[model samples]
Target chain A: SQELEQSPQSLIVQEGKNLTINCTSSKTLYGLYWYKQKYGEGLIFLMMLQKGGEEKSHEKITAKLDEKKQQSSLHITASQPSHAGIYLCGADPYGQNFVFGPGTRLSVLP
Target chain B: DTAVSQTPKYLVTQMGNDKSIKCEQNLGHDTMYWYKQDSKKFLKIMFSYNNKELIINETVPNRFSPKSPDKAHLNLHINSLELGDSAVYFCASSLGPSNQPQHFGDGTRLSIL
Candidate 1:
């Protein structure tokens, strides 16, 4: 079985500041997904990384998968209140099912 | 139009009661999945169906059953729910069974009293 561990279970950052959340997997990941979920709402897919050393960016957010494929990081630049939510990392290690981390709660104070 | 949608945004019932959640996706996907998010915000896969066929069934109890009438719809029915069943259930779909990014629904919050 594969498990994912996310660092900084919860974070509080000032608006316009940059922050990074890390996700580490117990096994090499075949695919890594980043999603954002507002309180009481469904998750919004942010980005997906498949190949090792792959990096993708959308607006102010960027995600990178390490060359080892065992760790990934999501970095947000000039964050806003809208970025405050639960950021979750999910990985498919066996190609059969997806395993998710405990999630990182981001609170961006204005 | 919403890519993925779920009915009854919230459900509250007594223990031992049975309930169902319906999910529909309009993205023309071939795979659908059901996930439960516990209070700790840990999301776990409960069931997955690809093209109306069961593909993955995690260690979920038999009391929870997932039905996919077609590739676009997946419904979950829980029997004799217990207090531990209180959580947010989300429905998601992808283009295939493996290595594809998934689109998710708003999720149904279930509360068992």
Candidate 2:
């Protein structure tokens, strides 16, 4: 079975500051997904990285998959209150199911 | 329009009772999944159906059953629920079982008293 570990179980940062959250998997990942969930809402897909060394960005958020495909990081620039939520990383190891990490709670204070 | 939707955003019921949660997706996806988020915010896959066929059934107990009458709808029924069964259940859908990013519903918050 594959398991995922996320660094900085929770974080508090000032708005307009930059922060990064890391996700590491016990096994090589076939696909890595980044999602953000508001306090009581569903998850909103952010981005997906498939190949090793792949990096993608949307607006002010960027996600990168390491060359080893065992670790991924999500970086947010100029964070806003809207970015405050639970950030979760999910990994697909066997393409059969997804294993999610214990989410990193982000609090951006204005 | 909502891509994925679940009925009864919140559910509160007594233990030992049976309850059903309904999900529907209009994304024209072939695969649908049910996930449970615990108090720790750890999301776990409970069941997955591809094209109305059961594809993945995790270590979930037999008391939890998932039914997919069509590719766009998946319903979950829990029998004799316990206190530990209380959690936020989310429904998701994708183009296929793997490689595609899943779209999640607003989730149903189930509370067992």
Candidate 3:
């Protein structure tokens, strides 16, 4: 069984639309991270959450960690075309042996 | 300078051969990891090293070995390579085993013929 699971394997939205990607875990998330990967490119770190009910934002992207530590969500506000990529969620419950989810592919069209 | 670098961005070789992929991270991180992404894009961890010491080794076969010369370099050597070895290998480095973000090399695309 996958320790981390993401919803909506793929999604598409028009530019300036808001979208959310959800990640669920089977165990407590010691540290949860979000990364974005373009085709044929390496992953780029977006954000990380260590405390429950923690919320972090960068530009138009914001991520929230639930108090339960089993679910996390990434919210994109007024997305742009450049926001399109594979969104991956990784969690290391014990702060070791991090595992990544299958990823949610996002496509923001112009 | 490349933070995390891997040589031979692409590799194509036949089965039952021996090959090596070299990875070096200039970030001076203490922890390094090897991840394999299969054709289906499912990424899995194969091994992790902390300060030249093997910290995590998955259920990988014996033919696959990871060597860390120092805190900045980790190389992978594969022997008797099987067809199943065809995939993308990624080298990533982080500050430590905690919540630090990992910096990954572009990746080495290996194709087994």
Candidate 4:
């Protein structure tokens, strides 16, 4: 069975501050994806990482994959109110279907 | 245009009733998937179909059936809906079953009473 665990189940940050969310998988990740979703809304894909030590950034968010430890991290730089949402990390252990983590809820206080 | 869309954004029904959620993708993707988001926001893959063929069914309950009419459409039918079935169901599609970024629909919220 594959499992994904996320750190800091929920986070609160002031505007302009930075925060990082982590996703650790029980199995090696063939691919890792990062997505964001507003409450009750559909998820929007942010980035995808496949190789170990790979990193990708979009706008204000950055994601990295550490294949050795089966870990991935999503970092937001200079957070804003618009960045407040649920950050989810998904891992593809078998290169087929994704198993998403429990998600990290982020709240940006202005 | 919505790349992936699911009909009936919200559904409310009594237990023991049957319901279905329809999904379509205009992106011409060859793969479609069904995912369930539980109350704690844990997203789990229920099914994945590629080119109208079932690719993955993650040990989901028999009551949950996924049908693919074509490469662009996948529908989920739930039988004997139970209160525990209340959750958000998301429909998504990708160019392939693996190593592809998926497009997601707004999701269908199912509530069983």
Estimate TM-scores for all models. 0.98, 0.99, 0.97, 0.96
Q: Write the per-residue lDDT of candidate 2 for residues A1-105, one digit (tens) a residue.
A: 899999999999999999999999999999999999999999999999999999999999999999999999999999999899999999877855787899999
- Candidate whose lDDT is highest: 2
Best by TM-score: 2
lDDT of 4 by residue, A58-87 (tens): 988889998594999999999999999999
Say which prediction, candidate 1 or candidate 4, comes out ahead on lDDT: 1
Considering only chain B, report the TM-score of each candidate against the true chain B.
0.99, 0.99, 0.98, 0.99
Question: What is the Cα-based lDDT of residue A58 in candidate 4?
Answer: 91
Q: Which candidate tops DockQ?
A: 2
Q: What is the DockQ of each candidate?
A: 0.90, 0.93, 0.79, 0.87
Candidate 3, B44-90: lDDT as tens digits: 88999988999989889999999998899999999998999999999
Clashing pairs in 1: none
Error of 4 at A36 (Å): 0.6
lDDT of 3 at A95: 40
Clash pairs (backbone) in predicted model 2: none
List the candidate 3 regions with Cα displacement exceeding 4 Å.
Answer: none
State the number of backbone clashes in model 4.
0
lDDT, candidate 1, B1-113, per-residue tens: 99999988999999999999999999999999999999988899999999999999999999999999989999999999999999999999999988888899999999999
Tens digits of per-residue lDDT, candidate 2, B1-113, equal 99999998999999999999999999999999999999988999999999999999999999999999989899999999999999999999999889889999999999999
lDDT score, candidate 4, position A64: 91
